[model samples]
Target: MSSLNFNLQEMMTVAASRMLAADDVCFVGIGLPSAAANLARLTHAENIKLIYESGTLDTKPKTLPLSIGDGELSDTALSVISVPEMFRYWLQGGKIRTGFLGAAQVDRFANINTTVIGPYDAPKVRLPGAGGAPLIASHCQRVLITLRHSKRAFVEQLDFITSVGFYEGGNSREELGLRGQGPVMVITDLGILEPDPISRELVLTHLHPGVSVEQVITATGWPLKIDADLKTTPAPTAEELYLLRELNARTQEAYAPDGLST
Candidate 1:
């Protein structure tokens, strides 16, 4: 077969990778979020703490976990505790530095809908409702969301709000006395977004290399916001690409030894 294409999924992973810091305590979800967190840990930010919702704290698994409950998370964890204490003591108690999430749909206010597509009691698409997103969003020092941006995925209003973003608009999160950093960045396949200083609504800040503002607007379901001096997302550097590839190779080798070759 020809060389595999790295589509939006890969782009999402790349986007998520950039949000991590050198020693952030990240509450990571599975899928793209997991890939990004692991890539960051192996690459530029080796000391970043990985926490799973299953109560594993400061986990340092050599391989990518299959889920939050993956045995490897517990096996390699610094410590494990009951679910209640993990949330009440560590997360809600303000120990987590960041929460990495993925969304099916997000609105201008950044309110997320992982719950459903249509109505509440009756719905067109009943999605996987929030498991720990509400707590994660409310308690983490900050949040980073990764999603493929499209008219459908980036909507004017979410079908059901599973996690509060800016929470009704303009510093409302603080007004309501919600503790934590809130959403500092939203990473998409097309670009990076930050909330307006005044409105706290999501606005386009940087378009990825080869992506245009017009294309981003076209993909958004609502009237998108754009700053006067929007920048271009820097292309992945040689070092970044090399490290990411190596991380992927190691993860594949460890997780799929029989299926993946050296």
Candidate 2:
């Protein structure tokens, strides 16, 4: 790919990497979040602790696992425990530093809906229900969500609140006896979103290269905030792109060689 034709997935990876710090204990999900977390682990944040929901703690996989239950995740993990211990003793016990997740739908308050698109009794689209997301969102020190930008995915109100964000706003999480930073950042294909200062609602913080404010607004179902002097997300450097592609290629080779051949 040309420098100008930056891949959206790669951009999301870059954005996700920026959210992590060295030695962070990340509760990582599969797919794009996994890619970004692994990229961060291999690149700048070598000491980053990777925790999978399948009872793997501080896992150092050579490549991405196809899912939480992938044998490689266990093979390469530091240690594996019972699922209950993983959540009760480690995650909910305040051991996790960050929780990274992706969403099908996210609202202005950073509320996520990964379960359904319409009413509970009657339905439009029944999405995959939350696996460990609600607990992760509640217990992790902070959460980072990633998704592609579109009006359909970014709704005014989610059909089902699978994971809590601000949770009725105004420090209600604290009132409800939940601790941890709700959603620190949301990395999307269009831009980066952070909580609004006043409302604590998700607002556009920065736009990716070649993306316009109007484009972001058009894609969002609700009105989005824009800083007058918003800066564009820096294009991925050649080195960054090279590392990301190599990582992806290695993952493909390990998990789907036959799939790639076709």
Q: Which stretches of candidate 2 lie over 4 Å from their true place?
A: 1-5, 257-262
| TM agreement with the true structure for every prediction | 0.90, 0.94
By TM-score, who's the top model here? 2
TM-score between candidate 2 and the true structure? 0.94
lDDT of 1 by residue, 1-262 (tens): 0242344455567767978999888999887788899888877788999988898988887778767788888999999989999889888898889999888899988878999999888999999899888889888889998888899899987878898888898878888787776888889988889999889888899887777789999999988889888998766666767766776777787676455446
Give the per-residue lDDT of model 2 (tens digit) for 80-168. 99999988989889988999998889988888899988788688988889999999998999999988899999998888999998877
Q: How many residue pairs clash in each candidate?
A: 0, 0
In model 2, the Cα lDDT at residue 43 comes to: 78
What lDDT would each prediction earn against the true structure?
0.84, 0.86
Flag clash pairs in model 1: none
State the lDDT at 215 in candidate 1: 92
